[model samples]
Target: MKKSSKDSVVTAAILLFNSKGYSGTSIRDIADAAKVNTATIAYYFGNKEGLLEYCFTYFFEQYINKMEASFATIEKGAAICLKRVVADLLHYQWENIQLASFVYREMSIDSQMVREIMATYSLKEKYYLQKIFERGFEWNEFRPHSIPYLIIQLKGLLMMPFMNTHYMREVLYVFPNEKFFEQKYLKDLYQWIDKTLCSDIQIKKEAIIK
Candidate 1:
């Protein structure tokens, strides 16, 4: 399907912002990348800040929808749900690395646009994770701990791989753009989640018995 002009602009903006950052990227850069005039971006999105806000909002809206769909189809168990959530998160981050990168960069700064996006979408994202954690607690699939801390850890796990791509390429010589690196990273992530957060077989059995 042919992408709309606005969609094209947003896609271009994501890449530019991810690579050059919010302050470094310009409206002309996005326009040139999108093969459209600057007025086109202005038409679709009022300004640079407006475009950034729309980009984040659109990304999270799609993310939430996908998460909801995954939750709906997955088996009714906390362990199963947790695994699916982690898998989905990993896949999404990998597929949308540019948007993920842009978001990670924006998160570190203090800006009204960032604040609004966080309050509007980031909080909702946190709530979804919290619900999963709550379910795990009730099912005894996860041990008791601070929900906020767990959320932070989970977000960090998901974001770190994409955020540290340069380090991975330079220090570890792992090119994330390669399928080999992506698969290996994802496998390691799954193992980390299983080891750190999941209940052992005996614990699950005891919980069931009780």
Candidate 2:
């Protein structure tokens, strides 16, 4: 299917943001790349900030859909669910670093933007993970700590490589764009996070202490 004008504009904005910072991206540039008039984008999205909001929503929707699909087959297995969640997160971060950078950049300084992200996508994302953890604990399958804190830690480690690609480039000689799914690279990190966050084996109601 042919891409929609709005999708084209958003993709162009992500590319622009990847090359230049957000402030450096202009509507005309997006328009030219998207092959739509600047007015077309403004009409579709209202303003640059509006275009950005759509970009955030688009990227986040894709991310969430991927996560949900990864766990779709396993409705009741907590360890499998956790593993798939981390795997989805690791894969998304590795594959979509440009979009992630756009988000992280906005989050660094724009209080309103950060609030908007939280109120919109972030809250639902957090709720999904928290529900996963709470359900895991309730089944006596895994221990539950603060779901928010565990999520923070799970998310931080998963996102750090993508967010700090420049620093990791200098320090560990880690190649961000290199084959991210190699067993020892992101996949290993995915398993390590799962092991760290979940139990060695699913336990019974008495054996497991939350």
lDDT measured at residue 35 in model 2 versus the true structure, 0 to 100: 95
Reference-based TM-score of each model? 0.86, 0.78
In candidate 1, which residue pairs get closer than 3 Å at backbone N, Cα or C atoms, i.e. clash?
A: none
lDDT of 2 by residue, 1-210 (tens): 999988788889888977877789899999999999999898899999888877777778887887777667457576667777777776676677778767766766757767877887787778677777877777655655777788887777667777767777899888776664333565666555455655545633224545
Best by lDDT: 1
Q: Which model scores highest in TM-score?
A: 1
Q: Write the per-residue lDDT of candidate 1 for residues 103-183, one digit (tens) a residue.
A: 777778888877877897788778777888787777677777789998888888778877867886799887766667667
| Alpha-carbon lDDT, every model | 0.78, 0.73
- lDDT, model 2: 0.73
